[model samples]
Each structure stands twice: as C-alpha cells, then as structure tokens.
Target: MAKPNLPVFNSPEEQFQQLRKLIIERIIVLMDSNFSSLINLLYRADVDEFKLKKALAENPDNPAEIIADAYIQRQLQKIETRKKYRK
Candidate 1:
C-alpha cells in the first residue's frame, strides 16, 4: 500500500512568524483600502489604543508591522492567561 501524504508541521516560533507575516499583509491591505476596518479590528483584538498610537507615530513608515506586532502580543497574552487559569 502507498503511504499517505501527511501535513508538514512547523515549530511554534515558525508558525507564529508565518501568522505575523500574514497579519502584516492583511493590515497593509486594510490600511490602503479600508483604514476604519483596521482600526475596528485593532479595537476588537484588544490592542492598547495608546500604545498603538504611540508606535504608529514612532514608526510612521511601518504602521502595518507595528499593528501586527501589537495584535500578536495581545493574542499571546490571552493564551498565557488561559493556560494559567486552566492549571
């Protein structure tokens, strides 16, 4: 019998990086075509408004990267909290 193809698994760090790149791309598209949607997403994702604004101001040329990093950090925080509570 032929062996079946299996999905490749990435390390956690690699997976996170891939997700971060995807998020940055999406944020860039939203910035160009629908900025309000990006703002709404940031708010919904629980990214700190003050920090995001500050980061954007500091990195005026790379707002997408800043926003994506903030979003990912928030998600990681939530995961940690959940793990802590579950234990």
Candidate 2:
C-alpha cells in the first residue's frame, strides 16, 4: 500500500494553531452551536492547565497532541460514566 502524504507543520506553533482549530471544530459539531458559544464552552471546559503545562514542560514538541489526547480521554471517561449509570 502507498503511504499517504500529510502536511507536516514546520513548528510547534503551527501544530498548536491547527490543534486549536480542530478542537473548536469538534466542539461546534458536538454542541451544534456557533463559534461564539463554542468559544465560551471551550473556555469553561475542563482542560487542565496544570497538566497541560506539565506536558509542555516534559515534551515541548507535541503539546497539541497531548492536549488533543487529553480531550479524547475526557470524552471517553464521560461515555464510561454514562454507561455505568444507565444500568
């Protein structure tokens, strides 16, 4: 199979810029809301600043991936909680 070519960003800054856009896009899709409302929700969302900072300190090159992974993990936890409580 041929490998697909992807746009490789030049720097961490570029990667994080894309990451923020992706996070906002996902939030909008999930909430069925506008950019302004989603921005407010993102502000209120449970993104751990401390952990983000720690992740940046540990692996400065992949902050965007770290944050995205955290978001995925949080969503999975919510699904698990709902499943457990719906019994």
Deviating ranges (above 4 Å) for candidate 2 = 1-44
Residue 18 error, candidate 2, Å = 15
Alpha-carbon runs more than 4 Å astray in model 1? 1-10
Tens-digit lDDT track for model 1 on 1-87?
233343355687776677677788888889899999988988898999998899889889988899999999999899999999998
Error of 1 at 15 (Å): 2.1
Residue 72, model 1: lDDT of 90
Clashes by residue pair, model 1? none
Error of 1 at 20 (Å): 1.0
For model 2, which pairs clash? Answer: none
**TM-score attained by model 2:** 0.47
Q: Cα miss at 76, model 1 (Å)?
A: 0.5
TM-score list, all predictions: 0.81, 0.47
Best by TM-score: 1
Deviation of model 2 at 66, angstroms: 0.8
